[model samples]
Target: MRWERGRRSRNLEDRRAQGAGRRTGRLRLPLPAGRGGKLSLTSLLIMVGLYFLIGPEALQGLGGLGGGGLPGGAQVGLPGGGSGDVASGPLRTTPAEDELVEFVSFVLDDAQQTWARLLPGYREAKLVLYRDTTRSACGVGQAQMGPFYCPGDEKVYVDLSFYGELRSRFGAPGDFAQAYVLAHELGHHVQHLTGTEARVRRAQRSSPGDANELSVAMELQADCLAGVWGHAAAQRGILERGDVEEGLRAAGAIGDDRIQGMAGRAVQPESFTHGSSAQRQQWLGRGLDSGDPAACDSL
Candidate 1:
């Protein structure tokens, strides 16, 4: 991607120097019981009840809730200290990491600008750059969760170290891949602004049994929205050769099925929260091919 000349976003909040507060007790959700551990209707109703009582925050760490960069939105925190290691001193970064920060800033601004033009009264969402852990309106965010958008606070949270894991562990690498992660999170911001998110939550509550399927649709739609931004960036000469491929690779890398396979678990389509690899690639490619948000109505 040709991003050095791009504009930096003013909505960025760099909290790397600050320490994360002390760890809080996590609320664990019950796993599905019975055949293949499928969530029983009773279990589903229990989660739905929790949702009504505590809002989405109650489902913060739950995989398939569309809160993280990866399919399950995994949350991993460092042990000891409220702020983790950075609490002891200022954060350090290599030149490459510094450049990565600038790159994300550019992507944030560029993607928001695209939305501002595409959607009326579109407000910019802030991006919080933190380390190890940070407090979000939804709950505590951890590095292992990858990048996520919290609708409660209308901000995107990201830990840059995840990029290294994305490259090495996930087998997805390239600057555009990193940008895709941010774009997808911002797509959640768009959902929040347009009432799509609220409506989905209502639907999830009303039909608890369909919650996972609803989440998959929501996530696929976000992938399409990200591709919509990619389309705009390409039109403005911001994309280069292989950039699209990088984004697709990133999308495929985090598919629930692929992640499950990586974990050495059986591929369970019924349990998928973020859809399969083919589904994600298909939706993302649809937006890229059409370059129209209308073409991205996966929901």
Candidate 2:
């Protein structure tokens, strides 16, 4: 992709220096689905009731309601004093990663620019670049979770190393593929801005049994919104010949079914929170084909 033609954003925050001794925190339990990664009131009440019923000992055995600083029991953390001296100086990276950083800034700026024009009352969300682990309003963010947008703090968190996995493991190598990850997270920010996030969370609470399904819809919508950004980017002629295909490969590569298979787990639709490979490709295609944000209504 022609990322150089895009603008750079001043809202980028570099926190890579403070990533040495970050504790790798993981969620050993489940969490309330939807609304990014916050604990819902209903989940809290259930936890309180459980605490009263079983005491702390048994609760801890059950992973303390996924309290290992993960979202629904995923790894989450940021480097603090425990992680050696957190870098306070400017981050210097290898020539390759430096280019990646610039690409990220450009993509973020482009996405925000598009949203500003497409949506009313849109505010550009900030991006935070960190490594190893980082604290986010959503949960403890580790590279394992890839790029995530924290609705709680209105910021996007990224560990650049995840790009290595995206390229090597997912087999979706390209600048556009990397940009798609950022766009997807930014799409989450769009969801937050439009109040779709809150509405989804409320819906989840109303039907706990369907929480995972709702979460999948939310994720698919974000994917479609990401495609919307791609549409806008393409309109400006930044997209190259294989860019769309690269993005589609990326969408399929990270589908819940693919990820589960990669992890050696049996494919189970009931447990899917991010849809299947085909579903992701379809929604992403919908947004890219129409160039309309409304076309991304996966919910």
Candidate 3:
């Protein structure tokens, strides 16, 4: 992807230097690697709920959420502090961090700009970059929770190191794959603007038993929306050979089914919130093929 010279987004909130010892300081979740070396499904579900329903404040209350300072101890809202610090950090990047940030900003700008132009009554959303732990309108967002969009705040929070996991453990390595992740989060923003997220939350509350399925549908729609952006990006002559393949790999890598399978359990369809790998690929493919946002409304 030819993203280096693209427009950088002004919506990026750099909270990397806020320092540690926060007000209600909560623990960070473990990364996809390390001692336990596995993503916790239960914790992630809790995070998803906090991110979308309760808010970040709820994260601090989770009993098992633990970890010392992030390698850099950069607090959220402090631009480029903890997660962006280069010296002695837990998830330090090897010179590519700036490049990754630039790439992320560019894609964000593209997606939001697209929405602003195409969607009626669209409001721009901010992207927050932080390290191990940070405070958000939703509650305390832990880096271990992976990237999530907090609808309450209308902001997307990401721990940059997750990109490394995207390349390594997730088996989806490429610039476009990273873009897909950002686009997926932005898709949540789109949902917020369109009231889809609110409807999903209402449905989840009204029917507790179907919450996971509803969540999966919402996530799958986001994947499709990401694909729609991919299609637009391709038409702009930025997509290279195999870029689509990289994106598909990413959509599959983070699927709830794949994550659960990696955790050594039988794939329980009812427990899935992000859809299966095949479903992700299918919806993403639909978006990529059509490039129309309306075509992405699979739910």
RMSD of each: 8.4, 9.5, 9.3
Q: Which stretches of candidate 3 lie over 4 Å from their true place?
A: 6-8, 19-94
Clashing pairs in 2: 17-87, 21-83, 27-73, 76-140, 77-134, 77-140, 77-141, 78-133, 78-134
lDDT of all predictions, in order shown? 0.77, 0.73, 0.72
**What TM-score, computed on C-alpha atoms, does each candidate reach?**
0.80, 0.78, 0.77
- By TM-score, the best candidate is 1
TM-score of 3: 0.77
Order the numbered candidates by TM-score, best leading: 1, 2, 3
**Which lDDT tens digits does candidate 1 get at residues 1-299?**
99874345699998876553422213346676658867889989987775564454543533221323343333432222243333435555556767778999999998999999999999999999887667777776666567788888899998776777678778899999999888988888998999988888889899989988888888898899999999999999989999999989988888888888877778889888788888999998887877788887867
Q: Give the TM-score of candidate 2.
A: 0.78
Cα miss at 260, model 1 (Å)? 0.8
| Worst-scoring 10-residue span by lDDT in model 2 | 59-68
Q: Of models 1 and 3, which has the larger TM-score? A: 1
Residue-level lDDT for 171 in candidate 3? 82
